[model samples]
Target: MEISEIQHLAALARIRLTDEEAGAFAAECDSILAYVAQVKEISTGGSAAPSAGAHKNVLREDVETTEPEAYAEALLAAAPDRDGRYLRVKKILGETP
Candidate 1:
């Protein structure tokens, strides 16, 4: 991404950075993207890209029974208000389609 694009992204994220910090991050992004582009220019000979470490799908048995009520209780404890089973949340309009 361009430096301006990076700055725009930071703004969207509500991150406040000094001009020098934004420029530094932009340069870092440019270097990383240049490296990626250089790699992409090479032909992989129809082979998959190298994996840093080979990892295969891990299979595990389902261990679910019933979640303890204490689990829900802990989460609800952080809630401003909760009705029996669910937490009550404030409604904010205009984002949903």
Candidate 2:
């Protein structure tokens, strides 16, 4: 990816990357892309299935009515700021509420 391409992507993503940062990130992205291209060049000599013998997701029924800790953590993580169980996001309305 070129520096200009990086800038265009940053604009589309609503992110602000400095000129130097954009150039550096573009080089890094290009390196990663090249690595993926190399992987694509490799031949899949023998493959019965795409993900053969891969671990199957043996899902079980919802046996218990309990929430996972990660679920609460994820919600709190999304808050701009948080205290206890409260999501301290920016106020959306005026005192009229």
Candidate 1's C-alpha runs over 4 A off are: 11-20, 46-64, 78-91, 94-97
The superposed Cα distance between candidate 2 and the true structure at residue 15, in angstroms, equals: 5.4
Q: What TM-score would you give candidate 1 relative to the actual structure? A: 0.47
Query: What tens-digit string does per-residue lDDT give for candidate 1 at 1-97?
Result: 5667877989999998877888899888888888888877877799676775888889878886666674778888888899887888777675766
lDDT of each: 0.81, 0.85
- Give every collision pair in model 2: none
TM-score of each: 0.47, 0.51
Span of ten consecutive residues with least summed lDDT in model 2 = 45-54
Best of the candidates, lDDT: 2
lDDT, candidate 2, residue 17?
95
Tens-digit lDDT track of model 2 for 1-97: 8889999999999999999999999999998888889866777786635774778888889786566674888878888888888977678887875
Supply candidate 2's per-residue lDDT for 79. Answer: 80
Best by TM-score: 2
